[model samples]
Target: MTVRDLSALFLDSTDRPLPRAARELASAGVPVFPVAPRDKVPLIRHGRGFRDATTNLAQVDTWWRRFPQANIGVPTGAASGLVVVDVDVHGTNGYDALNRADRAGLIAGWEFLVRSPTGGLHLYYPAEPGAEQRSWQAGNAGIDFRGDGGYIVAPPSLRVIDGETVPYRITELATEPARPLDAGRLRGFLDPPRPPRRLPTQMRGQGRTGPMKLANWLGGESTDRNRKLFWASCVLAEEGVPYRDALEAMLTVEQRDFGSREIARTVASGYKRIHGDPRLAGKNSASGAGTARAVVDAAPEDRLASARGL
Candidate 1:
């Protein structure tokens, strides 16, 4: 089988701009998952300033061992994959519409895909019902779908061909729909989930309480301003908002002395920027005032002072 056949096996008929070789492969009846060129996949640099790279399962575990002080509630290493989009029917130029559709479909139909340890998500779709297109986009950023029949997004190292692993650029092709593999068999290929490993006693020094333990510090006497700020920060953190923005918004909320309108604005901004909306943070009202006050009263004095600009 040629590369085009390989593309048909892996990609749908929606992705476009197939590379010449990929089209040739597709024409020759080769199955392929046309991935983008090497320089395209984003690379995160390693070293002192950068978050350590965990390209695979082993590296992920090693990073966890070294950063025992870090929280493990979330995956430490990032993984990559592809998202295919049907470009022929939707019109290749209408990428935004295609993206929204793909995102919705993935979220609604395939929640399991979201649980991957890798951060990269691949979108796959058919490339023309008949003719060949060159390339397609997975979504935002620089991710591209390439090949004559269809495209694929994979790590810079891995490549896919007619059931054979070889160094070939991902591109499009034409072929029958891919057969659904047994879910159990696929799971067997994945890294097994392990229990939370404990760090060494030496690594668990004075400052090394787990994330849960440190959260207990939120208890005790705090000002109304501080209390609101704390709750807002907790809400954002729980929702997976980035650290720096969450911190800034929390600070802004506190600095405004917890005025309802000002607090509302700060919360709204955070919701918009982080979680997509302010109301999703839940309604804050006079009903919670007494509870808020009580929480402030129970906070540590030093924490309260810090909250109140002391």
Candidate 2:
């Protein structure tokens, strides 16, 4: 539908944008639930999930009235006639991958699209009526299908990080009513053939992983920010990346222009904790959680301190 067509359905809700947006989406026959304003967490307490989304004007009004600032949530997959091909634009080269997918015609015949606050794209398509589609991951293909048990925060919702706000917007509005997403098209997407095993290249051995881990930390919103840094450091250190290089890469991705060297040192401690130890240094440590914790317990506090630099 055109922007005007969509906008026509929404009554001017200038005083309270979130509540107005929610009501407008519901009025268009899309079931909606309230998310904490400016955040994805549900505002309504109790067992409510996306399954509780309703198009009922009375219920919608009650929800927005109680939590006037609540963000809007729409369940994906077949239930709401939407299957979102999530193109994450963060790490793992999502932007390139999305372009390739589109070139390969993996994405077509749909129009609804939402740009995620975290630099990702949520491509929405209508699902086939009565289709029991569920959410699934497409390996490291950098795309996710948000169907069944998944929800999308509706547009007009702003995601704030580090005092900066990014709003999700619908880039492509459907001209006609969305049809249920096609099964064949979805299968082509969700189940691409696994490639033959190949040995790690030089790039894989000493590339991407360290920077990706660091990016994760920089982009994190965890209260345990210090812990996250420590964790990321260890991962990078294990990859054999030098402390200085790791710091530069992380800072670059995070867009920090300057900071004391301590930030790098603290992050590198994670690397040091792993490399200095005989087990992980030798790469003989068991993979996964057990080994991860052992590495943390071994790191010195001086290295894991959060406020060392800033």
Candidate 3:
């Protein structure tokens, strides 16, 4: 049968996957952008951040033509008015957590879902204006959210999880994302009841040292910069550093060699890995935890599929 035919599986490298996916998402009024093809790295991040996203048919056409191999990106929060519940399939944790959430009526309002190449799931919801949402490790295992300041890789892009390349496809397709889950209820169900750990001193918007500190800690090696920055950003996220604060901090060192685009990409990836097993923290570090995660998280995305992979 044809690629568009019934039961066609995997959208990897289908003819014009980027343009095709972009056209569909844009037609539904979803703001869209291009990402590094075969990789989830963002292509345009300046000026408006993901806020620069657009549904302009011509802009969409121009982007795909310019970066034919680029992946499709859907800015998670106000850009597209979306909030996604990311249920990871690295293990059964996401599944179990989702089940628990389901029983508690947490996921009852979900309107659209996508099955990720890695076997994870993406539950999409519309966003509410001025929503106080933030991207974080959900209270549940292997569960996370793409809310304000967050984004999700859209379909027809190649996702290389571990060494296996697959497509981000709809399990049951929809023309557009559905109405959002009840934000208040979602928070109540997903957030910890106790007071969260204090924000890092620099994250309070008080210190310029935060950036230098992370840069210093990460060292100055281009080869290791991406990986180090990836894990360091994760630690910053785990420590509850504000996104802008963390971005500034990471950017200080990122100036040496890595591009802002790389920083942006690693930060997002690091944010996602923060939810994994707590025990795996120091799998490769002599110093333990963060160091180890840095090495692994920095490695090629495919290498991340190993038992010690981030």
**lDDT scores for all predictions?**
0.29, 0.57, 0.59
TM-score of each predicted structure versus truth? 0.19, 0.54, 0.52
Q: Report the number of the highest-TM-score candidate.
A: 2
Query: How many clashing residue pairs appear in each of the predictions shown?
Result: 59, 10, 6
| 1-310: candidate 1 lDDT, tens digit per residue | 3223333332332232233233333334332222223222222224421122223444434443444222111111111122232222222332333233323222111111110112123323322222223233433222333333222332122333345443312221112233211111111112112212543234355453332332233222254333233344445555566555554444332322233443444344334433454443333222222322331233223312332210
- Cα displacement (angstroms), candidate 1, residue 94, comes to 16
Off by over 4 Å in 3: 1-16, 45-49, 129-132, 173-179, 195-310
Better of 2 and 3 by TM-score: 2
Task: Estimate, for each residue in 1-310, the C-alpha lDDT of model 3 and write its tens digit.
Answer: 1112211222332445677768666766777888887776788866554666788988988988998878888777666766888877665457666655554544543444566777677766666555445566664477888877778887667877788888776554333223345443444345433322543344455553354577666554555455457657666777777666777777766453455665665665465456633443432223222222321233323323332210
Query: Is 1 or 3 the stronger prediction by TM-score?
Result: 3
Pairs of colliding residues, candidate 3: 126-180, 162-302, 211-249, 227-298, 281-289, 282-289
* Model 2 poorest 10 in a row by lDDT: 287-296
What is the full ranking by lDDT, best candidate first? 3, 2, 1
